[model samples]
Target: MRRFSQFTCIDWSGAKTERPNGIAVATINRDGPPKLISPEPRWSREDIRNWLFHAAKTEQDMLIGFDLSMSLPFHDIGCYFPQWEDSPSRAIDLWHLVDQSSNDDPHLNILSFLEHPQAARHFRHSRDHVGDLFTGGTGRLRVVEQYQRETGQANSASCFNLVGAAQVGKSSLTGMRMLHQLDGAIPIWPFDPIPETGPLIIEIYTTIAALAAGLPKGKSKIRDRVGLEAALQVLGAPSPGPLSQYDDHSTDALITAAWMKNASRDKRLWHPTKLTNEIAQKEGWTFGVF
Candidate 1:
């Protein structure tokens, strides 16, 4: 298994504009406590991309996880979008498709893709249609999404669900653009094999990392100093204290970084039972779900 000198978790946001409080990043060095890197002024997705490029140039043997779905669910369907001829066949190709279509929108907004006539039919887009959407609806789930539930974590919102607070579709879309830009620069998990050195990005569900750190369901997000301290102690790390329960961005990032840095050692996580070559290329698995 690959050993990392540093572990990082970014609590990402897909909001239209900059999210100062909503986007946060935390890191745990091989010998230290988790620390926040996100500034008070907030960070743009572009900012995060540039930072990763810098890290790729400077850091050695680093593992950075982003809190977003890296690939859309294509396994059960065999293709991300069925019946749509010339739809992207590979995950990387899918990123390019989104990038090409969303060029007119600033910051790579994927709403254009969502509202596009070709994509609108299958995807339920209205707030009024939330109940019929991916997270709670009768829609078919991807293989990894089924695995997410089998592990006792709350069922993850499908990458197709683009509305509501539970929706991860927007973030996933924005992240795909970043993944596209970082291609060949920073290898992404499941989609590509981890390199022996330099920085690598992985898909992360912070709540899953929280569960692995012994947090209870419905309360996995660490918001308070005590809760953060407890989670860190479980991982044999120390707390810098003064963590906020309300600041979900920093709290999720902090707790996730602590737990994931420790959890990365288990070889089972690196090679999941369901991680076949086809799945790796079409529907990459979440990093901690295995």
Candidate 2:
């Protein structure tokens, strides 16, 4: 009986361009611990494609769990009119939106349509777009076909997750704390803590890893898991500092310090929060919030 191979990846952005650096890949073969693959920042799209293609060809029993969006648009655009004056813009510059954190409410953004009612009603499935002969005389069909066939993946558009929005919320909290501590201090709003994302990363990785490991989705069991602790240790996340000021660098510094401590240890760092009563017993800690 041959064992199946399992691959797990965490992608920072679902977009192709940023994926090289943000992607984390881990493979679990039969019985031993999983092997994690660090992101190769220099790996080009072609390089990744070739790697996946070669792996798929060689490993008949491989099962990949990509953090990136694999599905395409639910409906196809019948005829893409690239030259038509009325045609909507197909070239979307999504990079600018990448830095926007997810901790905040996303209903404020135009791209919210991807996850909202408008997209549900008007979005064309990538499958439909590629399955049908593009009628509008656009050459994009070739690109679609080549991408699909070569990648052995779907042709659908990728969507961002809610975590991205939550980062904004975290930043907001950081800013508010700063104002309170500073009393309308000199460098008011001098730093936006929205980008202090190590905590968010830690939380997300914990959740997803638990999900993949068939662990319970709630707080208590997740925080106790050794594997989750190990990943965080690898990430070297800092402890949440005092709610004094909303300092971006301070928050980052706190996490960096924690990472350093964890880095020096033989053991890994566990998920910080929990749903159990144990949290109440812990020093000045509260749970079920944030």
Clashes of 2: 24
TM per candidate comes to 0.92, 0.31
**Cα-based RMSD of the predictions, in order?**
2.3, 20.9
Cα lDDT of candidate 2 equals: 0.27
Point out where model 2 deviates above 4 Å: 1-3, 6-12, 15-20, 39-44, 72-209, 212-227, 230-290
Per residue, candidate 1 scores C-alpha lDDT tens digits across 135-247 of 34635566788887877654687767666778787888888877887766888888888898898888888888777778887877666777778877887888865654446
Estimate, for each residue in 170-263, the C-alpha lDDT of model 2 and write its tens digit. 2212222222222211211111111221111111222333322343434312222343444334553322312333222222222222222222
User: What lDDT would candidate 1 get against the real structure?
Assistant: 0.78
- Candidate 1: count of backbone clashes, pairs at least 3 residues apart or interchain: 3
lDDT of 1 at 29: 93
Worst 10 residues of 1 by lDDT: 129-138
